[model samples]
Target: MPTSASAFEIQSDFDAIDFAGGMIAEAKRRTGDNAAIEYACADMFDWLARFPEAYDCILTVGTLHHVDLTSALRAMSRALKPGGRLLVLDLVRRPGWRYVLINSIVWDAPASFVDGVNQIS
Candidate 1:
């Protein structure tokens, strides 16, 4: 099962759901699968509560930053079946010596400067 806090508009072979009505419509138009995508515009915590230890895998990208980190982690942990895998892709800032040095040097820079630095690959 695929889930998203926001809407998705891509076709896929597996099941998918999101918390947006517009996304649901887009999925209906774009998806080729016979099974209709199920969706709900509800809070993640409440939605997740419906399924306990039900999923074999959970994948999230760039979503954890928008919610309570501890609570989200707990919810995901509870929702996963035994031996389930949870994969996450998101940005994180670590406080280390290098980070401290960079912050000290650039903390006073203008927003444009910071953006420019971040744009570097």
Candidate 2:
């Protein structure tokens, strides 16, 4: 990411938008006001569907599991230019003992931590 590049950060959840907005503000502040990022509270599907082939790259972190994965991928692909890159970082479910172990550990976790985990799961 360049200091002069234009970026859009859109989140379907309103609460998540505040976090993104704060991060962008902090980045701009640290970089002496050169980072150009726009934040929005909107559904990714609806927003991405409007801008066909408009973006050179699309990046999604820890968000895909919350919605319809197939549709989300299609929308993201449609919104990107030819040969554009799509970067995704998210959690995947583990089966058997791994799942059991994770559930056991989370059972004893702090209330706040467990709440966060539940939201993502």
**TM-score per candidate:** 0.54, 0.52
In each prediction, how many residue pairs overlap at the backbone (N, C-alpha, C within less than 3 A)?
0, 0
Model 1, range 1-121, lDDT digits (tens) per residue?
5577444754543335555678667767786555644545566677668888776666655555566555665676666666666666655465544334233321232223322333333
State how far residue 35 of model 2 sits from its true place (Å).
4.9
Worst 10 residues of 2 by lDDT: 105-114
Report lDDT (CA) for all predictions. Answer: 0.56, 0.53
lDDT of 2 by residue, 14-73 (tens): 111223456646645665633245555567777787788776666666665566555666
Score residue 41 of candidate 2 by CA lDDT.
53
Instruction: Name the runs in model 1 displaced over 4 angstroms.
Output: 1-15, 91-121
The clash tally of candidate 1 reads 0
| TM-score of candidate 1 against the unseen true structure | 0.54
